[model samples]
Target: MAGNPQGHQEGAAGAARPVGVLALQGDFREHVSVLRGLGAEVVTVRRPEEAAAISGLVIPGGESSVMDKLSRAFGVAEALKRRIAEGMPVYGTCAGLIMLADRIVDGIRGQESLGGLDVAVRRNAFGGQTESFEAELSVPVLGDPPMHAIFIRAPVVAELGPGATALATLDDGTVVAVEQGNLLGTSFHPEMTADYRFHQYFLQKVAGFDNGTARSSRP
Candidate 1:
């Protein structure tokens, strides 16, 4: 299947705009590698200022609470919320997906999120780390053969609003991927595997939509 991340294009001098992956936690390094492999400039998003120049952002998987705490401490949570609100293309996986959701189960207590995507998510809905599993999924946005997805302490989307679209799901009914306007999210980590399709798909979305332009809100 052919997948391309949006906004990135080959400049005449082989130049590329930088894309940043929120580095508060999770596999930020792997995401950096994945974006680089796609021939786009990559940067680690540690502070809001560092993220200001990037065309898009990826929120990597990790402890959702910790990410939220550090994001506030580092002043990124507000910036991220603002960026996405202003139209920066964002992608989140697992805990990252949880942060993007409108509501969370918060089994661990006092759970909070950035609440960008209009979806309700249950943390570790299919069980925690010990119950992690893999299955074939149909991601129509990617096309053709089912994509192999691995779920680790992942959240299952319970519901999404009219603006949201289901991009992929498991055979037994688990929302694996979703797109709400320029914001795209997934419960699985694509960087953990050899496939770069998901990342490419997100980049294509960013390039085409964000394009260094700030949108008023999620479309």
Candidate 2:
């Protein structure tokens, strides 16, 4: 079943693209707010059918295991796999990052993932909520001035496959963000903050340009 982008109730004039947030469970509203603030049409995607019409998808931070089960139950998992296979742009944060990872270490038994990024992530590598912390990262792709990253029981990309490119890292060199093809994954919550550069970069880099064409990769 194809998605209904027209079903969206909130939109901005000259919206670059309709971006869907997997609304099954998570901090989805925060993502929606950020996308809308960036002048993009926002849709809350619950069923697999809703995954079709959007130009890109955002999987927000939540319980990776629960999100996985919900995605499968709603049939959005298969639909998402198809769209991503067709080169649809996707940005995942926290648990969303876990969903896009090819492999996850210490994941719950039978916990499944959508899998696109060629990287291995260890769930809650940053420890529990008591261990949650924040740091300033120099993400050159988003320009200087350092991006503030918040970690809440966040996972860390333990290793990258040949195709993965590290975008941000801890001062000690731990990978926190990465990109592969049309997909972007981050271990931090960009939506929870006021900065919109990461989302804008996703639009410019992964979701294609305003003219509806993929942007040429930065040299």
Candidate 3:
């Protein structure tokens, strides 16, 4: 499906905005390519200090447990928490959603997160890798024509707290995408396709725009 080019209303001309992709694991390269294609400078973030330098960050799809281990091992976990608390825009795909979540269901013991979104995500809610599939999603925030979503052993937002807004969902009403303040979480991988609306939305609506524009706190 063709994406709406005008989905982003903040500033189409991507100038100095440098978006970062968490390079610790997963499909970070694909995200980097997409961001660069959108005309924004891209940065590969592997360290906490590096994470602080970018205007926004993308956590790609990968094993949630593995990502958690790596983030803590490399000291990126705490740093990310600090950044998100400061209202830094961050988008997470698949396991990325697991990382941004404040609550996780059936997670490993001692598993920690950056804790931005007030949602409960169940890992592998769509079953194993073999159960992976694609669907056309109607994301109202990005406007018409529906976006193609790629789900690979994806997690699902089983329960959204008072803070999060449901962006897209399955036909059965399973929450697949959510936006909470400057944080965006998707169970599907937007980097896997040609459509760039999701990334653009993050840049324009969350990253470039300040804290005042988004929900300051949950009501």
Candidate 4:
């Protein structure tokens, strides 16, 4: 199913190019719509075999621990990490960022991550779901209007290595967006915003990967 260009809804096209939404949890539908709006096929990703044909993937915000457990239970965690390591572009939102991080300071007990990106995430560093909010960011990769970001129980990028580029931050200098290699992780939910710029940025990255124009950045 797809969403609006930015909300939770279903897609009308089944034959479009598939972009998998790690449907283990929250905001998966919202992401489906954003990818759909970008003219890609939108669908929920389940087992490892189900991920074979997708060119790109989006890991949506939710309970990171639950998502971790679910992905492992479904036996696709290794496949995901392997595919992304091989150059597939990925975008992670909120809890999704936590999933992509190498070190998680506040994740669920004994939870394992995809470990594809090198960054540290502090879960709920900006507060809880009730404290969720939005802000306008000067995301150059996005465009002129600035990217509108929505954060719900979001994580913050604490420290980055040489491969990471800080894309956006909060007033106090909290790291909220970082690009480590082909992986793009955002502490906010662009899928919940009116702006498709963030979606556009990731789409461009995916396109670059598809065309072999993407520069490798491993740390």
Best by lDDT: 3
Q: After superposition, which runs of candidate 4 have C-alpha atoms over 4 Å from their true positions?
A: 1-17, 214-219
lDDT of 3 by residue, 1-219 (tens): 212211222333543436789999999999989887876677899898787666678899999899999999999889988878767778999999999998999899988887889999999997998999999999999998899999999999999998899999999999999998888999999888988888888777543343245433234
Reference-based TM-score of each model: 0.88, 0.88, 0.88, 0.88
lDDT per residue (tens digit) for residues 1-219 in model 4: 122222211224433335678998888998888777677756688789756556678999999999999999999898888777777778899888898888998677798898767788898887766887888778766557777787788889988766688888887888899897778899988887777666777776666665565544464
What are the candidates' C-alpha RMSDs? Answer: 3.3, 5.6, 4.5, 5.4
Q: Name the lDDT value of residue 116 in candidate 1.
A: 77
Model 4 TM-score? 0.88
- Candidate 3: worst 10 consecutive residues by lDDT? 1-10
Q: Which residue runs does candidate 1 get wrong by more than 4 Å? A: 1-17, 210-219
How would you encode candidate 1's per-residue C-alpha lDDT over 1-219 as one tens digit per residue?
A: 213443564444555557889998887888888888887678899897876666788899988888888888898887788778867778898888998988886546776788778888888788878999887787877876788888998888888777788898787776778888678789998888887788887777667654444433365
* Candidate 2 Cα errors over 4 Å, as ranges: 1-17, 206-219
- The order of the candidates by lDDT, greatest first, is 3, 2, 1, 4
The Cα error of candidate 1 at residue 122, in Å, is 0.6
Superposition error at 150 for model 2 (Å):
0.8
Q: After aligning candidate 2 to the native by TM-score, how far in Å is the CA of 31 from where it should be?
A: 0.3
